[model samples]
Target: MAKKELKKVFNLNSYEWWRNHRRVVTFGLFLSIFAFYLGNPFHKEGKVKDTCAKLNSSFQITGDEAMKKLNLKEIKNYNNRELANYYCERYLGIK
Candidate 1:
């Protein structure tokens, strides 16, 4: 009986299996997306703030000054403050 069931399961087509389990697949996909959104590193403002504080304490400089002093690459789309925040976050591995 077990061998017969195993054969039947193994013989099932991939498309037919997917069609039968569409609700489970959709739920799993939704869960994966929700987890990704909740755990996204780039959205952590507290980390950036903490990194900026650490940079300020260690270097006595603002993010803009640190960007120039470290010779970090400039991103044209971001303003000076945003660029500084990004630099601080990246340089310190906060992101």
Candidate 2:
């Protein structure tokens, strides 16, 4: 059989189907990888709190003070770790 005929036999719509399902496919892959990493005990939550505490002591500034210094607004959807890390890495001149 010709190559075109062989490809038709193997469902040539596979590429088109993948193109249409990109978002679902990407989310599924991210979830699977996230689940694998979330299984680790060393990766427990509240770790950022401890890190933040260390950051506070090391920089001589509490989280609240750091937030105020950085001018992070009081939003319900805030990322303290990101803000604190930014201060640590950027403002405090810590490596």
Candidate 3:
């Protein structure tokens, strides 16, 4: 392709570039938050340890337990009562 043609084909200004890269930006945000939670000293230590331990064990749990282990309750998007209950009923098991 010619330079002008390529430039026309892929016009990338700040707004356009950011719009096209929104998913990457959102993923980066999620990663940053997850990393922060992983290292947060005031909390997450015991919860993470317990969750890891539960995962390592050959056990099943109800959805509530799954949510607890995954820290889903703390997730803003999926933290509503209905969703939490749904996760408990549909995705969790006990063993």
Error of 3 at 35 (Å): 0.8
lDDT of 3 by residue, 1-95 (tens): 58777777777335878889999999999999998887786465556455545544565444456556666754556634445455444444522
Worst 10 residues of 3 by lDDT: 86-95
By TM-score, who's the top model here?
1
lDDT of each: 0.70, 0.65, 0.60
The clash count for each model shown is: 0, 0, 10
Point out the higher-scoring one by lDDT: 2 or 3: 2
| lDDT ranking, high to low | 1, 2, 3
Better of 1 and 2 by TM-score: 1
Question: Higher lDDT: candidate 1 or 2?
Answer: 1
Q: Highest lDDT: give the candidate number.
A: 1
Cα lDDT tens digits for candidate 2, 2-30? 87897899886588888999999999999
TM-score of each: 0.39, 0.38, 0.29
